[model samples]
Structures are given as C-alpha cells and as structure tokens.
Target chain A: MFTRNPAGLAALLTFVLSAAMVFAQAPNLGKPVSPAEIAAWDINVLPDGSGLPPGSGTPADGARIYTAKCSACHGPEGKGGPSARLVGGEPVKNMSSEKTIAGFWPYSTTLFDYIRRAMPWQQPRSLTNEEVYALTAYILSQNQLIGERDAMNAQTLPKVRMPNRDGFIVRFPDRTP
Target chain B: MNKTPSDRIKRELTDLQAVAGNGLLHRRALLRGGAALAGAMTGYTLLPSALGQQLTDDAWSRVPGSTVPDYGSRSRFEKDVVRTLSNPKGEPRTQHARTPHHLINGTFTPNGLHFVISHAGDPDIEPDKHRLVIHGLVKQPLVFTLDTLARYPMVSRMAFVECGGNSAPLFSPQPIQASVQALHGLVSCSEWTGVPLSTLLDEAGIDPKAKWLIAEGGDSPHLSRSVPLSKAMDDAMIALYQNGERIMPGNGYPMRLLLPGWEGNMNTKWVRRIQLTEGPGMTFYESRTYAAILPGGKAYQFYFMQEVKSFITHPSPGLAMKGPGFYEISGIAYSGYGRIAKVMVSADGGKSWAQAALQEPVHSKAFTRFRAPWRWDGGPAVLQSRAWDEAGYAQPTRTQLVAARGETAQVPPVTAFPSQHYNAIVSWSVERGGEVKHVYA
Candidate 1:
C-alpha cells in the first residue's frame, strides 16, 4: 500500500522513529514491589470502600474510645471545642457556617478514612482498624445518620448515606475522574 | 554633557509625562534610568542639602566586614522581613505562615520564607529512610527511595502554588483593614526541580482502568489528595529540590508532589506514595475542607485552578504613599490558565486604566511582576490592578465578583477562609495624608 504513496511511507517512518525516541527517554528506575510489602503504608480508604480493612464496631465501643482518646480536643461527645465539632451541625446556610458530619460531609467512608489516618490529632495512626470503625460508627450515630446498634464494618461504612451527599457540584467537571 | 546635577535633574523631570488620569506617568519612564526616576521620587528635582553632605568614610566602610558563615544569611537589617505565623505556639491544629509580599520583590519566593500550611508541625524526616511507593491499578507496583529518584532525568520549572482560600478575606462585605500580607499572601512561587511523574508512572505500567491517583504525605496527618491521572501524565513532578537546594522541611523536605497551578493542599508535602485508582478518593481535604460554598447553599467541589488575579503590593495597606510624586505602582499578576497577557492599573478606582508593563519572560503559572508609572498628585485615589490571562479571562472587578460569589453578611476575620478560590480585583485607597488602606471601591 505504501508503494502507491511515498509521502505516506515517509510519514510512517517518522512516526515510528519519534515513538522509539519517546520510549527510550523514560529512565525506568522503579523497583518492583509486592502487594504484601505495600500494605503497611497503604492506609488510604476511598469513598467506594476500596481499601477499608476488615474490622467491625458499634457505637457503644466507640463511646468508650472517644471518651478515653478524643474528648480532650474534640470536646465531650464531639460538640464544639477548641478544634472542630464533629457531631450535629446547623444546616450550612452560608459559606461561613460550621461544617459537621451531618451537615456537610459527602461520604461516610471519609470519616473512617480520616479517623484512621489523622484523628486524636497528637497521636495519629495509633488506632486499630476496629477502633477506627467504632469511631466512625459513633460519629455517624451521634449525627443521627445511623442507628446506635448498627455495627460499622468495611461493608456497611460505605453504604451509610450522608446528609450532604448531593450537595456538591464539581467545579471543573471535565477535569475530574 | 557639562550640565550641573540640578540642570540634568530638571531636564529629566520635565521629560516625564502623565499617561493616564490622576498622574499615572508613561510606563517607559522607569526605563529612563535611576537618576531620572530618583528625581521624580522627590516632588522637587533639587536635593541640594543631601548633595551638599560631605562624603566621609562610614564606620562600616572603614572596618572589615564580619566573618561569613558556611550557609549564607540575609543582612541583619532585613531581619524584619519574615513570614507572619498564624500559630506560633505550634498548637494541635493546622498552622499558616503567610509570605510578606510587600516586603519582597521579584518572581521567586525564597525557600526560607515560602508560605507553609502544615496540618501538623513540619515532620523531621530523615532522607535515607524515606521511601516512595507507587501501587494499585498498575501492571507492577513499584518503590523508589530518595536516592533513586535523584538519579532520574529531571526538569525544572517556576510555578506558583496557591491555596484555594489565599485571599478569602476579600470575600467580606466590607474590606477588612489589613496589610497586603494578611489579605493576599498564601500564594508563592519558586523554581522546583524534579523528575516527571509520567516517567515513573510509565515504568510502573499503568492499567487502562486507572483514572485517578491518590498522593499521600508522610507527615503525621498522612495528608492525601486524589489527582486526575491525566494531570499526573501532563506536568506533575515528584519535586526533590526547591530553589536550587534540598526542599525545606516546612515545604516538604526530601520530596513533595508538585502539581503546578493546582490547589496548594493537593501538592502533598513529604509525599510518600502514589496509588493509581479507578476514581477519586473523595478524601477529607477534597470532600470537605477545600470545597467552597456558594450562594443558595450548594457548594463547589474540585475548584482546582487559581484564576487570574493581581494586587498592587508596593502601595498597598501599611506601605504609605510617601507624598507620592512619581511612584511606580507595581505588584504580582498570575493565572493558572497560562501567562499573564496584560495588566491594567487604575489610579482613580476603575473609571480609567493605564496598561502596566509586564516583566519579561513571564513563565506560565508563575508570578509575573506588573509595573505602572504613576505621578500621584497626593489626593484621594483608589488604586487597583486588573489582570488578563492569555486564555482570555479577565480578573473580575469587586462589584462583579461580589455579585457572583456572595460576600459575608458580617465581616470575617482576616485569617478566616469563608470561601475559597477568590480571584477578584483588590482595591487600595490612598488618602491625601499618604496613608494607604484596604478599600471596597
């Protein structure tokens, strides 16, 4: 087919040469890692419960942990405090209004994710998977989004619908996933 | 050629002319050299008394200078020029260090004074033990140490990382009385050198299903944000060096993820992992903290771009006009879209504007200094700057911006971020007494 058009043949040769040049430029220095080896550092939990660890807890277990570990900065039962209030929030009337789990959080999985990685500000990443699930259950239950007896696990955490789930509009829709 | 100093000064002063209303001189007047500009500075051309002072050797000129240290430091006289910290006590919360824009000039912010918003205090991470891993949704999960990343082919670029709420105080119904640093200082630029994220991702062999990548930091909070996979392939970098040295601890020592022109929080500091995934993580930072609330109660999520914005730094609040004879109104103009196309200066509110000259080699997404020659008559004047980006977006005026993004019902504290991504025109009113203050004109 190229014999009928010499220009087409030249174009194809140039494209192949440029593609080769591009492939040659990558350094390819990354050492292959195993999934088991990455587990220690892989703490991220997505909204779809992609990385949630296998654990379960109820609001009762979470209340005991919250009083012992979190009440100092977060105030008793996650009311207003020196830090941020985590429980009930007045509806977000304006931009300045306080954002709480019930008022503004979009996904319940984010609560589990944040608590697992950053809660109890001074001692971060100290909570076990079960403790994180319990805290998530307690916060959700306090916000009246979940029942007091509902045990939160990897399966149930992502299923809890947040009050402000549909409140957000992606500013740049075209640029997102 | 034999003219006296007075004759030359008078001639130069006479040559200067106003280009716009309220004594805005020709932009090229700055190019006329220091002697001419100096004469213009003093309302009168003749500085006979100053010129008559005897030229005696000063104490510093007579004695040898102090010994130099191994690491350089700015002059002690410049000690006052430093970042203002929001949490000096290092409390258990996010701390903000704002750059002093009025005190400094030029495009690149010094490494020591770069604005930092540390969720927890800066972590003291030892470079030797630090590891960077790329996993999830890739053909092969990969790991790289700091030393290995340093060996790769690296590129350098000047980029500005601006917080989504940099100038949030401007969202107040009434302009808050504050310095330019207090109002607009969260954004800063520096030359960042790093290996392209695409090169590393290419080595990992991306799966076709991967659409987003979650970048996490090694800081105590383990702060993380999900970035579009397309951006990672475009211009993202695993930046190792900032301003020709190892990155500062506050700015993410060892390494940080540099997403040029994106929200500041998304550029995770002390970045340790990049996990490619099928969708956004919808992490705490994105799902709540950075999401901006709009009028009618709905919020705007993923507002990534720091849009076209500019503010007069020299004559802004706290920098008095100094009897303003011929003052050059200058400040920073930048846009995430591209290079700044044009900047217009208005001495009398936004009624009439004179085009300001943009500094040469204006890099995309970096601070471009815009200067306008002004011959202020020392009367009441509301000074403002409006910038336009190459992408055809103009910085909206105060009235226009407030109409679109509602202002606070009550004035917010200067430190409060009521809303995010505020990129409107900033106005500074100059009084007859030469005192400049924040204004809503």
Candidate 2:
C-alpha cells in the first residue's frame, strides 16, 4: 500500500508520529491517588464520627495533657487566656456573646477535629489521636458538658450532646427581618 | 477652591513649578517620582511612591518585602495596611488582618491590599507536588495536578468574599471610631479566572445522592468547609489566577476554591482535597465560629448570602472634608443575591434621603460604585448611605439590626454583638471644623 501511494504513506507516518509524541509528552497528567494516600490526608471527622480514628482517653488523662501541651496558650483551665477561650462563657441566650466549645459548638466531634488539626498555637497536627480525645474530654468536662471520668472514644464522642446543637437555624436563602 | 478641571490642572502645574524653583525636588526624589510615573504609564505601578514611601516608613518597614515576582508583593509606599488583631503573647499565626477599605477606591480590591483572616496561618506548598483529589460518592474518582487543571477550559469572573464577622464591631453601643476599611475590611472583591468546578465534577460523574462536598486546604489547619453541591455546580470555581495574574501566596497561591458571594471562610485557600458527602461535615468553622445568635436565643447557621450593604468611603473617618462646599458623596454598594437597584444618601441622619447615581454595569455579587452631588454649607451634619438590591432587600439601620439580632453586654469590649452578618447602614458624623468620625444614629 505504501509503495502504491508514497505521499499517502508519508502523511500516515506523520500522523502516527505526532499522536505518539502527544501521548509521550504527557505520560500522566497526575498519577491516580491510591486509597492509602487518600487515607493519609483524609483525616476529617464528621458529626456522626465518620473519620474518628481508633483511640480512647479519659478526662483525667486529658487534664494532664492539657496542662503539658495546651495550657501555655489556652490558659490554665482553658478559660480566658492568650489564645481563644475553650471552656467558659454562657450559652446563647437572648443576647449574643462569646462562644465556647461546650456552650456554642454543636458537635463534640468538632473539638477533636479542631484540636487534632490545629492546636497548641505553635505546633499543629502534632497530637496523637489518644491525646486529642483526652483534650476534648477535659475541655468538655471543664465546661460541665461531660462527666469527669467519662472515657471519650469514637462511639461516645458523637453521642455526647452539645448545648447549642439545636440552637442553629438554617436561614440562608430566606433571611428576612 | 471652587476651580474647574482645567483651572485645577493649571494651578497644580504652577505649584509644581514653584516647588521645583524652591529646590524641593531633589535628584533622588525626581528619579523616584519619574520611576513612579513610568510605572503608572506601563500599568505596573503598585502604589504612588509619595504615599507608599510615607506608609512604609511609618509602620510596614518592619515586615518583610517580597523578593520574587511570582509570589507577588505590595508597594512599600502603599498605606493601606491590614490591621492585624491578635494576642501579643500568642503566636501571630491565628489572627485577622483587616483591609483598609477607606483608602481604596473603585470596585476591584488590589490583591496586595486585600484583607486576610487566617485561622491557622499561611502555608507554603510546592506546586509540582500539589495535587487536588476528587473522591467520595463519584463514579470515577480523579486526581488532578496544577498543570492538568490549567489545561481545562477556563472562565473568568468578578465576585466578593466577605468574612462572616465583617461588621461585628459595629454592634457596639457607642459608635466605633475606625476607618471604613478597618471596620469592614474583611470583605474584598476580585476578578478570578479558573476552570468551573462543575466541569471537573461532571468529569468525575457525581453520584445523585451526594449533597455536600468538603473542600480542604493544604495549610496547617487544613481549613475545610462543606459547600452545597448546587453551588458547586452553579458558579463555584477552582481559581488559579487573581486579577488577570497568577494567585498570590497570601491569597491562596496555586489554587483556591472561589465561592462567589459566599462567606469568605467557605472559599478555602490553598485547596488540596474535595470529598463528596451526603451531609455537611459540620467542621469547627461552620458549626461554631461563623454561627450567629438571634433574638429568640437560637443561633443562625449557614447564613451564606451577604445582605444589602453600603458605606460612604469619602468623608469617612480618615479622609476629612476640607471646608465642605460642593462635594460628590462617593461610596460602594453590593449584594450577594443580585445587582444593586439603588443607593440612598442621607445627610440629615435618617430624616431624609436622596437617591445616589449608581455606576454603570452594576454586576451581581460585585461592588457597584455610587455617587451623589452635595453642597455643604459648612455646618454640622451626619452622612449615611443605604443600599437596596434588585431583590427588594433594603439595608437596615444599626438600631433595626440590633432589634432583629439583639445585643449583648460589653464584656469582650472588642465586639459587643457577635452576629456574623451585620449589613447595617453606616453613619459618619461631620463637625463644623471639617472633621469626620464614625457614629451610631
């Protein structure tokens, strides 16, 4: 066939070469992320405890960890310190005021997620899962939201109700006076 | 002082000649001014050297300057600094830097002067290693690199991003004496260019049951927010460029989630991952920090759309009136829902109002400049502006907002009312001596 039509053979060869070049240039725009890679970065915990890692911690253990790691910035008892206050302040009444994890935070899971992802002010994402759970328990117990001896695991953390859980009302598209 | 345009130009030229004769224009000064003029001519000028140098010497000299061009830095002379509010003893990473709105003019905010509200500080990432993974509840989970995403079809848009607590300080009983930018600088408008998120989501083939997509950043906090899929498919974009240039490091270099008209925090910067889900992730920012307490002791959550709001930039706190005679009252009005219909200017407090002229091409979810002609008799007066959107939503007064949202005691002193969205009418009191100040009417 090539011998019969030399021009056609030349055009065919050019087309094939260009196609090969295009494929070769961009071998893979980006490699497919493996499930293991996703798991390493997918550390988000939902309100229903979807991303909670396997860990257990008591409020007593949390108190000790809080003193060692968090107290420098978040105050001695997580009340009115250089960093954001974690424990004190009243719940949402008729008047708007400062928000605390126990009084304002709707999900207990958020405490764990926030502390695990960003805490200690200077060093972030450095706490172990057990340390995060213990810190959450200590902050909650200090606010009188959880029992002092209650061990916060994946199951109990989600079950722990927050004061402002039902306080939030969806008023997005229709926010009239 | 009542000179026409041509007369003003001639007078300015005479003044320049007089200054030159007085030998005030030194060779170094002339060189600097000439460079500034050349920069202005080429449209590469960041700020006028006269203003930039003064401001730099005053406060910003201590901060570092950008050496690399790709990273993008501001002019040293630019006086519009981000007023940072943070604990002096704690790490400065977790702080809010307010944009100087009063110092800026027109609709589009300069990238360098844009406000920043950092929850866990800015992160440094390598673009070559940066990857955006789209998984969860999809037929084909895909991972895209910066170059790959850039290869897709691109779209450009102009929108605004406002922090949920932009005007929380206005809730104070006594009017806060601050520049408009210092008080409301958390909000900023920019022209963003990138590929539509819907195009990527379509390629991934989203599942019918997926309701929310969690957008996570690569920063230390890994800042994440659950954005509704409807919005994602409607107008959301993974922005790669800002104001016709590559995104800056401070403003989410490489990639950012540009959610038009949504709360600023929802537009995650340095975006790295997006996971489709059936419900909101209920992250710390969404469930707690951004929520506002209402009158009935209930908190308002997911209050995404910024309501109608407007404020007079000229004759504001910083820019005093020079023996007010004939002046054009200028300001900006914007709405998240739709285009601005009208802006009403009130010089006699709330007793009477006059409709101000809206600038042409009032784009939706963007800043619309407005101006009204006024002849002041050099008397004490109160200036205010009220905005109305195409949706018939009128900007509320401070009293009305307080009545609707309720107010707390002045315990924190910084913010008396913690309502995340406070789009109320802002008032500026003018004294007989041509001094202007913020006031609550």
Candidate 3:
C-alpha cells in the first residue's frame, strides 16, 4: 500500500528482504477494504469551486444581519476579538504578517458559501442568503473594499479586489526551478 | 535554595496576590511556581548538587537510566504533567483534552497527553481489520489494509502538529488563568514514521486533473478533510507510528495523516481512506466547525497551512526566578516549512535581538531548540524571542499582524491561523519587587 512507484518498489523490496534476512520477519496482518466502499467515501472542495453549492449572496443583505449575530466575537468591524478575525487590514503586513480578510481572502464565493453553512459561532448554518449578503456588504464596507451603498451581488462581489489577490507565494519554487 | 515552611507559605501568598487577565497571567509572576518555567533562577527546581558528585566506586560504571521501564512515561518527578483542562461536560463533543504545558519542557510533546480534539470523540478500532482506500481522481484506484502498508519502506520525521485553535485566548488583552497547556499546548512534535504522500499518490496513480484530496477518518464522527493537491504532493504523509510506539489509541492508533506545518484539523486522525478528488469534502466539520466568519457576516475559504510562528515557553508569565542570578534561557522553535535557522532573543522587547544557541541536530520541518545563559538583574527588564525559519520567513509582530488584518464584524477566518500568528515577541517586565508582568509598550 505504501509503495506506489516502481523506483520506491525496488527500495521497499530490498528493505523487506533485508529485514527478512535479519529477523525472518513476522507474518502480514490487517484486513483490506472493498473497492465499492471507497467510491462512496470520496469528497472534497475544488479550486474552481466545483464542490460549492448553487447559492449566491449580496453584501448589502449580509451587513445588517451580521452585525446582530456576528459582531460580538468577530468584533463590530470584523477585525476580531476573542475568536478568529475575519476581515479588513492589508493582507500581509510587511511581507511577514499575513493577517486580515480583506487583505488575504482569495475568492469571493467563499464568503457566501462559508456564511450559508458555518456562522453565528453558536448556531451554524443559521443565516440565509439575504442576511449573509448584507453582512458581507457591511464587512467589506468596513474594510473599505466596498462602499457603504454598494450592493454586493454575485457579479460585484467576485470583482472585489483583495490586496493579496496576486500576492500568494508559490511554495518551493527555486528548489525545483 | 530549599524553601522552608515559612518561605513556601510566603511564596504562596505572593502567588495568590498575582492577578489574571483574559485567562493569562496579568503579571509574568502569575506564571511562576508549580507553573511551567517558573522559578528557574529563583529556584523552583534545581538539580541537586548531589547529582554532580563524583563516584569512585564500581557504582560509577553503572549505566545511567538503566532503570528505564518498558513503557516510556512522563518523569515521575514531573507527575503533574497531565491535561489540566478537559471538556467538563465530557461527551458533549469530541474527547477534548488540554496538554500539560507547564509540566512539559523541551520542544517535543509526548503522545500520551498530547491535546486531543476529536469530532465525535475517540473511536475504538481493531487495527487488524483496518483498511485504507485510495480512489477518486486516480488512474488506478487502490485499497490497502494495515498489512499492505506495513510492507512498504517507511521514513521518520520529528515534527510538530498543532491545532488551529491553540492559545485562542491569547487574542485578548486580559490574562486568562486557564492554564498554559489550555492556552498553547495543542502543538506537539514527535518522530512520525510513515510513507510519503508522493509515494501513496504514485501508487494510487492519481489523475492529473486532481486538484484536491479527501482524507476520511475511521472514527465515529468520521472526521474528514479536504487537502490541497499541491500540499499533498509536497509534504503530506500517512503516519503509522508515533514517538517510539505504534500510534497510541488516543492518537490515531492504526494510522493518521501528518500534514507537515498544516492545521491540525486537516490532518485527519484515525485515517481510513484517502480519496484523490477534484473537490473538497465539505464535511460538517469543515463547513461548520473550522470555517471563519467575516466582518459583514460572510466567511472565507480555507487556508490550511499554518504560517511560521514561535513562542518563548520558558520564563513565560507565571514562573518565578531566583533573585538576580544566572539562568539558562531556553525554548523550542519549529516551522511548517523547515528547520529554524536562527532564534533571536530580545531582553528589551523587539527593539534589538541577540543570537541564542540552536540545539544540535536541528531537523527540517521539526522542532529545534535554542538556549542562552541569562544573567538576571533584580530590576525591571522585558524579555522576548523571535524565530526565522530556514526559508527566511521571520516571525511577525502582533501590531503588525493586526494592522495588516483588521477587525471585522464576524469571526475572521482562522484557516491558516489557529491563533494570532504575530510571532513578533511576548514581553514580560521584571519589576524591582521581583515581579514579572505581561507588558505591551
């Protein structure tokens, strides 16, 4: 199971052989699973938002509702309090500090999807699309990413520019490059 | 310095006089004593001078630690090293247990009492019947039992794994007496033996289109997570052994995935299946538990990798020191990327930095220790430390992080960060009264 490649195969075989040559090695143990059972278990989100459900929210509707339910732990402005901070600030402060949502969030759809599902701290999945949109608007407005009057529909929300939109550093670039 | 009955009583009185804020010690003195790192110089514990005596008899030839027991456990001298806080309600959720931070010293956290954050509590699994399946966006779907995995050659890594919510209370200005382990012991490092994800993916014959992979747990709630294909291909692994033993039941007994430097939530425990996928699992734990809420009310997407950060566990608030004498300054530093190249200790906050000694055999993506001999003066002074990973990423400051990431109406997303990542420095002022307090300015 662990040895997947042919190159690794030779190494593994040599290792198992040497171990056998040493301790006469014990018998194999542990049962395997059925194939069909595995197909039933696979699930994960995608970069293209493939796993995202069919739903959209506007920032206008997200603001009012968010202030009442989320303003406490996340702070009235979204900077953060005792819980995790969710919005505003320059994404990475001086290249070292990767803080703030308005500064770091890569995609806008995550806003709608995240609120529609997990939120309110105490009660998850309690907010509707309209409330989520208003809250989103309020948060973005607070971050200065969007204006107070701006209605963050599906189109406008995606267009919203985050400071770190193109700033993500690709890992191990020079090592392989 | 052995404390007399009166002296012990006097110390206890001083401890009671200590105030608390936001679950943290208002004064660094609150951290001293029966507290972790407390009284290093002032004398909470000292190796008996008798330990340094020379032996001329055959007893000198005796192998030290020859009395080692079969089962490795915390030192009896450090008996209080157990989880200080636990879910009082018990089964209300996962069997969440806090680490005994004050009791444990050094960079690595032993597995026995490592903080546990399971979704539906721990599951009792029969290792013999366990199975691991690899399918999804893979050319050749694969299924392996515990036996098949054991056949594969394994590699070991001494690295740290931390929960995203470690030290969640540190965000507040008030000191929270909740205990240091409860505040920051969610992280621990060990010698993890396993097969690399690249090897597993090669075996699974993953499809090129695979952008994500779903890792499912064998436990009751079946805690599952979606890891980025890039990270999986880069440094992910299927760990079978921890420390020197088969993975303990409290840990992922049969097996658990170790996502180097990634958030604890994603390294699904009791790993059952790893399905190569084109999308995320969107498990309740993800969409509901780990997701972050924004200022306006909307939440953000997943940022799984934990950034570079470190803390000076020693001389932290609550511990007391001997009166103005020599003390060994030490602490552990680890990164999700690689080894910590250099650790700079600042006695004057972050204003200036001085080099600290890096412990030998500094392993990559693992905890490396740093130490220095400190000559303390019985007066006011602030102490702090900062770490730079091998990749040249220096720990940031709290003010800098806050300025970069502003306040929001909703709980900001803690995808990449479980707690504040501003590793700028934590300072404690040693007052003339021999008192230490957490200071900001």
- Each model's fraction of native contacts: 0.75, 0.67, 0.07
lDDT scores of the candidates, listed in order: 0.88, 0.78, 0.62
Higher-lDDT candidate of 1 and 2? 1
- Give the distance in Å from residue A166's predicted Cα in candidate 1 to where it truly belongs: 0.7
User: Residues B331-376, candidate 3, lDDT per residue (tens digit)?
Assistant: 7777777888888776656665667777778888777877654546
For candidate 1, state the interface root-mean-square deviation in angstroms to 1 decimal: 2.4
Q: What is the TM-score of chain B alone in each candidate?
A: 0.96, 0.81, 0.78
- lDDT per residue (tens digit) for residues A1-177 in model 2: 899999999999999999987743422344456667788777788889998999999999999999998888788878856677888787767545567776678889988888887776678778888999998889888988888999999999999988878888887656574
Better of 2 and 3 by DockQ: 2
lDDT of 2 by residue, B1-441 (tens): 587644543443344321111111212223223443323323334444635444336454778855678665667676545454543343644566666777777888878777776766667789999889988878877799998988877889888888888887887666778778667877888899998888788777799999999999988888889899999999999999999888878678889999988888899999999999898888888887777777766888788788889989887998888764445678888888788999878887877777677777888888998876555667888888999999899998888898888655553455223647889999998888988988888
Q: What is the C-alpha lDDT profile of model 1 across B85-132, one tens digit per residue?
A: 989999888899999999999888999889999999999999999999
Query: Stretches of candidate 3 above 4 Å error?
Result: A1-35, A39-177, B1-75, B175-179, B292-300, B406-424
Clashes of each: 1, 4, 66
Task: Categorize the docking of model 3.
Answer: incorrect
Candidates 2 and 3: which is better by TM-score?
Answer: 2
Looking at candidate 3 chain B, the ten consecutive residues that score lowest on lDDT are: B18-27
